[model samples]
Target: MNLILLYPEEVQASGQILSLKDRRFQHIAQIHQPQIGDRLRAGLINGPIGEVEVLALSASEVQLRWHLAAAKPSPDALPLELVMALPRPKMLKRVLQTAATLGVKSLWLIHSYRVDKSYWSTPVLSPDSVHEHLCLGLEQAGDTLLPQVHLRKRFKPFVEDELPALVAGRRALVAHPYQAQDCPAPAWQPSVLVLGPEGGFIPYEIAKLQEAGVESVSLGSRILRVETALPVLLTRLFPLR
Candidate 1:
């Protein structure tokens, strides 16, 4: 893990010292093999980046004191919301982590024509599982801000009623291979990107999205999996500032 993420409740009464005896402690003890007085990169969830000095270590736990007063600023969050068709159980885990790692602050998981009904019942959608994967992503990127996820189970109601307003005043785009404009140049602007399921959105769905102010865009002839396409579309739309 690039950063040891500490939760708000982990703070001791002094507000400076925190302890870990969970997976994080195991990761530190096994991966880092830290020494007393050695400092490691850390940050508070949705807070600033800082260093935590190792005060004590044991096989089961570790105690750390933060220098939060001198903490650095966290990375800038992306001004984008990802609206994706819920993938299968396995892909869902990766997607959550990938989206969080890439700084997507908002996500709307929606239903599409090709999406399997069984996919919705997966345990990966549980609050705990989602939170865990997102944390893993944050740890990988040394990020602290957690992304918000929304679920829309009905396709028609969401597209016809809610989507237009969501896309309004934003650079909204739907990634479709057919009859689509080439993806636009990278720019830092508020945007909403709609992605489809494995076989892509049906023509009728694309039309509904277009009517809702979402322009269809393409990344050329090669069809990419959802995992590959997400990062490409995000980077192509908004490069690092």
Candidate 2:
């Protein structure tokens, strides 16, 4: 990993000391091959960027001491938010990682008519697993800020009860492949884009989203998987910014 992440508990009275027994230890020892006194970039989750010196190493673990560095710059204040239909477990990991890499500020794992109920119960939904995926994204992009992720289990209530406030004062677009206008390229204002499941949104779901101020948009005639569609949509919607 580019910037090794540390937990709050890992920080010692002497500053930050991470146990090499952690997964990151393996990453460093195997991939990075850092030597004692060697410095590496590191960060606390949702916190500052800093440097860590490899102080000691062993067969079982490694020890690190951190030197406080400048606080990481805040991520861009993009108006774009993603409300994505829950994909399969494997795809979920990729989606979260990709979204994190692209600098999405917030992500909602949304439920829709086409979504499989079982997907929500996957172990990948656990906080630790989610954080792992996000960490990979951060390392890939050399970014330290973590995106906020929200899970919506009920489709109708989320749409009828919560979506309005979430979309307040911003444009909302729902991506569906059938009978919709083309998806617009990224614009200057903040926008909330809702993507449907692999099979696409049902008519009733689309109607409810529209009632909640979402405009239906298409990504041309060819239907794409949720993973493929998400990056394409984000790039198109936020090309220059």
What TM-score does each of the candidates earn?
A: 0.96, 0.89
Tens-place lDDT per residue, model 1, 1-241, is 9999988777633338777999999999999999999999898898778888999998789999987755787788999879999999999999999999999999999999999999998999999999999999999988999999999999999999998888988999999988989999998988999999999999999999999999999988899999999999999999785
> Which clashing pairs does model 1 show?
none
lDDT of 2 at 140: 71
- Model 2, 73-150: lDDT tens digits are 535535677899899999999998988877887998989878889999999999999988988887776677788899
- What TM-score does candidate 1 get on C-alpha atoms? 0.96
Q: What is the lDDT of residue 198 in candidate 2?
A: 86
> Among these predicted structures, which one has the highest lDDT?
1
User: lDDT per model, in order?
Assistant: 0.91, 0.82
TM-score computed on alpha carbons, candidate 2:
0.89
List the RMSD of every prediction in angstroms: 1.3, 2.3
